[model samples]
Target: MLKLIESLIRYEIRQNVIKERDYVYVRNQLFNLLRIEPTDQDISYESIGYPSDALDPILDILEEQHILDGSKVARDLFDAKIMNVFAKLPSEIEDLFFNLYKKDSKLATDWYYNYMKALNYIRSERIEKNEFFKTSSIYGDVEITINLSKPEKDPKSILAASKVKSLAYPKCVLCAESEGFAGNPSRDSRDQHRLIELNVNNEPWYLQYSPYTYYNEHAIVLSKEHRPMKINQKTFENLLELCEQFNHYLFGSNADLPIVGGSILSHDHYQGGNYVFPIEKAKTLDSWKKDGITYNLKKWPLSTLVIKSKSKEALIKKAVSILDKWKNYDNADLDIKSYSDDTPHHTITPIARIEDGFYTLTLILRDNQTSDEHPLGIFHPHADKWHIKKENIGLIEAMGLAILPARLKTEMAFVKSYLLTQKQLPDEALKHKDFAQKILNEHQIDKDNVDEILEQAIGEVFVSILEDSGCFKQNKEGISAFKSFIKDELI
Candidate 1:
């Protein structure tokens, strides 16, 4: 434990989160946490690659000593306890971030992201284990990631978590209260977490890095208050304001309706990151100019309207007008109904960024109304695509990046064997049998190329899924109908 403590301090120093002057102070803090005596023996340290190198073994020793149970939940809680001791105070971090921001926004974010990783708050080591790949498709290079960052809970831990009563102190995971909160079995530990408070369009907001980074520098911007996500004129104004604050990042939000919105609906938030999604690469299918703003129809699967202008106010005004029209839009010919009786069905997954001095806002039209044939929203990923992804096509996926379930990692292995040997899939992967067979019929299979074939097939499935979510089909009639709406309502 002493050796690990020395190594952790050295690692943090190497990462620039700490310095040589604070050696004794940091070591004493850890010793107190472990309830151990101070050690006078000199220890040498080296980086074994990541912070987890020193932290994981320390956590294991704590479990062996019965300081924490050998369960994922317990280990998670205690490890955060250890890391937070080294993390800067929220105020210190905020001060440093703003100081850097005054010079350059990119430098500020770069430092912030590195600091979060250095403190193990971003869990960089585990996120690297996630299965990530990109395959070329008609739209662009569609990204598929079989997420494996989240550890599978053991049955004992699962049972314990199930028995714990729920508490609502934080209200939701995205709430401001999550910072420095000591999580229980039912919640995740955020002891090492910090939030940088910012004002967006005169309203309080906080910025934090996502622990599970699907892309580079994945960030969450959340409201200070607990409120549901609602896209309005103010949403456009706020998005533009956020972009001004983080000029190099793209900010977006999921649709505000069920089956098309993000997993978190109770709390309002937007995700921003430095990575460029496939949707941004899509070409303009057609374009029109009005009121000094250029509106382009994107050639992507999702029904997207790209609003571009030099004036921020002009972009927001036009976007809000389009949004208002969409709320009441209906076209029986295309099976799009804005509402069924009193329940509304139309919304948009909106993305904002600055491109070549032009403020750009992309609105992907979404509807959540269900029919008897497809109870899970007519625009959702259909039943055929459920073998891969059934979750809502949130803002990220609408941008052509698929965050697949962790189960795909194992299920695809079984699928590969079945594809080569004609072996029956296990009960666990039965859902993949038909999809795998389709792959067999489409391409010649061999050991070296089966994996590539399966990956491309998954990419194709993701494309079709996006097409299904599209309010306008990519056909002549569908395109015509879409144009009519823009001409009649928006123009």
Candidate 2:
């Protein structure tokens, strides 16, 4: 009977009727139904409001297994109460609920509890940091600093205009106001900082920051409000008019499909910037000159688009038509099994490449989800640990410092080492090594020497992993294979 109740609750939770926020209430009700107090509580259907008629049969089954007592509840009763709540929920909510529940078996019941804890931590940290900033008179005058203190006033209008809703749970720690403000002062202090604010045809515009920028000059043009709409001729024309003001500029959008990662804003916007290097190198194809439309395929991890026309009006119309087609075809809710058929609008980042005195365009699509077979989600070492004293690990590593490595080695060595020592090398590593060797051969390296170098690198990486579980083995072969794959793909 307890098992049946547990199954029911699980189903309901997955169905969405009982949300994570309501877990406390549900738990309380279960406790009441069981008539169990904190001091001497046990699992039993009778204690938990089971009908008298239903209790006998369940009791008999429990007695047969010697798993129940008249005065105390069965252990499975606790499980059943939770499961019953989930089972009663509607279907739409089931997938996300179950997915999260199954993600960490031991912590399923503590989902809301953990989230609240994280939120409290974020709030406390934000208050503590902001209090310092508030008292620091030296940097208090900047608009960015002021904005952080009053983000609610700004309201992320662009995201709201684009119809992007905040996470249903609440308080997105990923791009919260506190996180943005925390980095504002240093970013504003940079020497090359230039604010490129633009108002498109008098429509209110907001600035957008890029995620993982590959160029010095990168930003997005966003609508004043968070809303969703098809990019029409007027929209494109306005953007094109803005584009003409700068020679080295590229424009892109999230479209209605699976929006690109890091575009947390739901506002209608287009990303653009004046990059230092020739953006064309990032494209895949050599040239895209079909009739009036041109497409330049970009290198891996870079996507772009370039349109040339006799008149801005014509260009805008063409671009709008192309985008509209993509939007219609790439419906997010559709379970389009064939990935190749999916539209590129939201999945790929488009980059405009100019090469050999001609304009070209490139598109770099999202990585294939099926390719990630690792048991753990995509997480690097030290992913969870936050460094209060240092800057971001990415920036530090990029600058050739090993602050993270040193800290992990010294502070977290024991646990890290244990994790690494337990992992068995997956077979895919060998295949990747072979593929890397092929790339080296093509590059005119001696096959034996290349293999030796790769083997040595792999062994060293593995040894490091064994010593510090926090460190992942650097798969040089996998890196080489990825490079080769990208080259071939672009060709």
Candidate 3:
């Protein structure tokens, strides 16, 4: 335990997070947290390449000593508590971020991202274990990640969380008040968390990295207030503002309605990152210039329109105009209704980035109306595709990246074994039986080829899922209908 502690302090010094002068001070803090007395015996400590190298061993000892409950949540909470001692105060981090920003924007972001990982706030070690790969499809290449970074909640932790009374102090996870929060059974610990402040459209916003990063430098730009998400002309303005501020990054928002929006709709936020999605790589099938802005219809599965302009004002104006029109637009033959009774159903997943010195925005049309034949929604992933992914196709998946559930890791292993050995699947993996049969019917699977075939099959399903999210299909009738909407707007 003492060696682990010494190694951690040395690791921080090597990372430049702390100095040699502060080693004794930080060491005493750790000793107090672990309830251990100082040792006069001098110990030589070897350097650790990563924070988890020392942290994992320390956590195991603490668990064995009964200092922490043997649950992922408890260990995670305690580790954050330990690392918080080494982290700079919120004000100090903010000052450092901007001071570096003045020198170079990329340098600032690079340092901040590394600093977060060094603090174990981003959980880099577990993230490295995620199954990530790219697969070819008709609409460019789609990315798939079998998310294993998020630890499954044990039954006892779930029961304890359920028993604890929920508090309203922070309101929600995205709130600015989450900074430095010690956390409870119902909340994630934020002791090592910090937010960098920013101004968008003259309103204060906060920036933070997503703990579960889907892509490189996956970041969340959230409103400072605890407010519901509403997409309007201001959303476009704000999105463009963010893209301009971080010209190298792409920013986007999920639809602001149920069945299409992200999991967190109560607090307004936009997700951006350094990575370019498959949708961005898609080719444009048609183009038109109107009102000093250029609009291109993409050849992807979803009904996406890429709007480009050097003038941010012009693009925002036209984008908002299209948004308002789509809000009340209806097509009876296609079952695309703007509203059913008093509930409106049309919204958009908007993404923005800088391309060749021009500001660009990609808007994906969305609808959430349900029908008798499809209880979830006519445009959502049908019951057939739910075996693989049934969650809302939000901003990330809409951009041709699939964040599949953790169950797929275990389930797919069982599926592979069944296909190879012709053995019966366990009851828990029965959900994939029909999918496996479909794959078997389509392809000849052997031990050598099963893995590649199965991954490609999953990618094909993801393409179909994105197609289901498209308000306008890619068929002749659907394309004509879509072209009609474009033609009408042109007139």
Q: How many clashes (backbone atoms < 3 Å, residues ≥3 apart in a chain or on different chains) does model 1 have? A: 0
The number of the candidate with the highest lDDT is: 1
Candidates 2 and 3: which is better by TM-score? 3
- Name the lDDT of candidate 1: 0.91
Clashing pairs in 1: none
Instruction: Quote the positional error of residue 409 for candidate 2 in Å.
Output: 11
C-alpha RMSD values across all candidates: 1.1, 21.9, 1.2
lDDT of 2 by residue, 383-430 (tens): 122221122212111111122222222222232222234233244233
lDDT ranking, best first: 1, 3, 2
For model 2, the run of ten residues with the poorest summed lDDT:
138-147
What is the model-wide C-alpha lDDT for candidate 2?
0.34
TM-score result, candidate 1: 0.98
Going through the candidates in order, what is the number of backbone clashes in each?
0, 59, 0
Better of 1 and 2 by TM-score: 1
lDDT of each: 0.91, 0.34, 0.89
lDDT of 3 by residue, 333-448 (tens): 99999988899999989999988989899999999999899888888998889878999999999999999999998899999998888799999999889889888888888999
